[model samples]
Every structure is written in structure tokens, then in C-alpha cells.
Target: MDGNQRETIHKIEKLLVERGLRARTIGSTDFPNVSPMKAVEQLMRQCSGAVILGFPQTVIHQGISKPNTQQEKNITDKQLPTPWNQIEASMAFMIGIPLLIIRQQGIEGGIFDIGTTGHYIHTFNLDNYDWIREPSFLQPFNEWYREVLVNNN
Candidate 1:
């Protein structure tokens, strides 16, 4: 992973810890066969919830170009060999739906799964099975969680 991606993961992990959620980092630079689902299951067993934030390459093999105004045009013009976005989006949806169902059934704690792929931010609300694109949505949710789940009776 690049420096910027590493920094982002670090910051996210810190935030999870501050919010009273147990966080773990599980990835291998050597083994190319690592499955993210396995890590998620392990973390879920140990913590109330788990947040998985991985690089685009981990989920999408295609390389994204540097930020540019004309980038959208360039991307649309090309015939991508693989639909990485669609695949990752589908996987996220699948994972989140089950979590939401469980949460609605009165699960002890909720899950917040977020990822940054290229320039897009993808978030899944395990409590509702809602997919949110804006990162700012987390701010209000976090505040509510602290006030209601953590601080109040």
C-alpha cells in the first residue's frame, strides 16, 4: 500500500478505537490469497464490531489514475478489463444486508463497514442495510452513538 493509503487506514483505526470499537489490522504483503472475509469473521468474534478499511488494490485490481479534472472522461472512454467497482459494491451490499438484519433483531452492537476506493467513499450501515456515499454521514452517527449508546441509559 502507498503512504497516503496507510495513513488513512491508521487514522480510521484510531477513530474506531476512540469510539470504543475494537479494531484489528490483518493483511499480508507476501500472500496474495488473503481473504478479507476471514479477517472480518475473526474480528467479529473478538470485538463487538469490526471496521474494515482496505486499499483499492486489495479489492480492485485496476489502478486508478492520479486526481484530475478530466479523469472521469478518461475513465469512461476506456473499456475496463474487469468491473472491479461492481464486484466490490456487490460484496459490500451482501455483507451489510445480513448485518442489518441481525441488528434489527436486537444484536448487542452495530457494525460500521467503510471503504475508500479510488476517489469514491462507500459505507454500509449494518443497522439499516443502507448504503451511504458521504463520509460526513458518519459524524452524526458517531455522535448519536456516543450520546445514546455510550453515555445515556
Candidate 2:
């Protein structure tokens, strides 16, 4: 995981702990093959609640010969499934717990600016989370988390 992801996870864990919720950090290996379903199954078996976060690669199967823009390249139809959507869908399906996907964008001074960098999306249902757009993912999840989970909890 990148520094930004780690920091975000740390903040999330802290909040969970403060709220008297149990939290655990599962390694990337636990999410093998970019399958959100598998990760959710595992997490459900281990914990009553979970927050899965990471960037999963999306493999482009057939599309334009090349990306028309950098953002387009970052998000394209791929042969491989992205873990973010999978996890969101799984969480929404199984427990109705809120799922947040954080998309990190841009690098400045070799450090990710959490303020202007990350994107957040709330998937209360499987269908909506699966249809999440690329640019929408560029919104910072922390802000939304504070508004939704932290504040509400």
C-alpha cells in the first residue's frame, strides 16, 4: 500500500477504535486475484465489521488502440475485475455496511496531497457501487467518512 492509503487506513482504524468498534488490518495478499467477493467472505468470517481499502488493477480487454487522455487510461474496461468495486458490492450485499472507495490522484513533491488527491464514494447497494465512475473516485474519501461514518457514529 502507498503512504496515502496507509495514512487513510490509520485514521479509519483510529476512528473505529474510538467508537468501540473492532478493526483489523488484512494484508493485500488476503485479497488475491482482485476478488472483492472473496475478501468480503473472509472478512465476514473474521469480523462483524470491516473496511477494505486498496487500488485494484483494471485490465483493459478490448477498447481504443490507446487512451485518448491520461484519465481515460487510468480507468478503462478491462479483462480483470477491480477489487474496489467488488469489495463495495460485497459489503453492500452482505451487511449493508457502508463501503467507501478512495481513489488517489496526482503526485506532487513526491508526496500525495490527501486534500486535493483522493476521491470518495458511498455504495449502499451493490448495483450503484458497481457502476461507480472513474472521476468520481477522485474525490477524497476521508471527508465523506468524517461526514458519514465518524460524525454519525
Candidate 3:
């Protein structure tokens, strides 16, 4: 996770914990030796819900060369990592896990356009990657996740 995403994850963990909900990270204390894909599978098998911080940040997985596809030529701007996180999102949907995307606030802050539709989520990161006592954007987010994770509604 990038620095911003790390902070975001910590905040989410804190929020979830405050509500008496447990939170798990991909690595750090657990699954430190596993591949991200494997960790994803492991988490999916365990957690009933997932949250993706789709903050337009890209984390490129080295050593995996892109195969020759028609779309390869279309992506002229190779700076941004291809949306690899979408795989987890798709898997969450397939597994019937509730999923949401946390984005930044402002014009560029929102759900990513992955070319297909399924109500891809977008919620503001009112913390703005800093420590805030009362992040305004988090209220709606808390409500949504509380329903999904706690109430199962």
C-alpha cells in the first residue's frame, strides 16, 4: 500500500474496531510471506465484506509482463498501473461479499471508470490522507458499511 492508502487502511481499521468489528490487513502481522493473489483468496474465504480504496493510486506488480492484447495498443499512457485491483472487486461480487470503493475528495476523487458497469462505488476520503477528528465524508461511509458489515442489511 502507498503511504496514503496505508493511512486510509489504518483509519478504516480504527473505525471498524470502534464498532466492535474486527479488521484484517493483507500483510504486516499476518500472511507476510504470501503473494497478494493468495492473500486475496485467503481474505475472501474469511471475511464477509471488503472495502477497496480506489483512490486513483496505482501499485504495479513487477515481474508480470503484460501479454499482447488488443487493448495493449490502446493504453498509450503506460504510467498508470492497469487496474489490477478490479480483479478483487470482481471476485467480491462473485462471492456475494459487500464491497465499496473509497475515493478522494474533489473533481478527481471518485470511483474509477473500468469501462464496464455494476454501480462501481465512490465515497470521499474526507480525511484527505491526514489525521482528522471528524472527517465529514466518513459519516455516510460509516452508515453504508455499518449496514453491510454489522446489520447485514
Cα-based lDDT for every prediction: 0.36, 0.43, 0.57
Show model 1 residue runs off by greater than 4 Å: 27-40, 58-137, 140-153
- Highest TM-score against the true fold, candidate: 3
Please provide, for model 1 over 3-81, each residue's C-alpha lDDT reduced to its tens digit, 9 standing for 90 to 100: 6545555555565567665444344322224476554344334433223332333232344545555663322222221
**Candidates ranked by lDDT:** 3, 2, 1
How many clashes does each candidate structure show, in the order listed? Answer: 0, 7, 0
- List clashing residue pairs in candidate 2: 59-78, 118-139, 118-140, 119-138, 119-139, 119-140, 120-139
Candidate 3 residue lDDT tens string, 5-105 = 66777887787777666776565546756788877777776776776655544434343334575444332322232254666667776777776655454
| Per-model TM against the reference | 0.37, 0.40, 0.59
Estimate, for each residue in 1-153, the C-alpha lDDT of model 2 and write its tens digit.
446445555665665666566564345325445465566566655543335443424445466544676555443443332444454445544554444443322211111123322323322222233222334432433344454454334
State the RMSD for candidate 3.
6.0
What lDDT score is found at residue 26 in candidate 3? Answer: 66
Model 1 RMSD vs true structure: 12.9
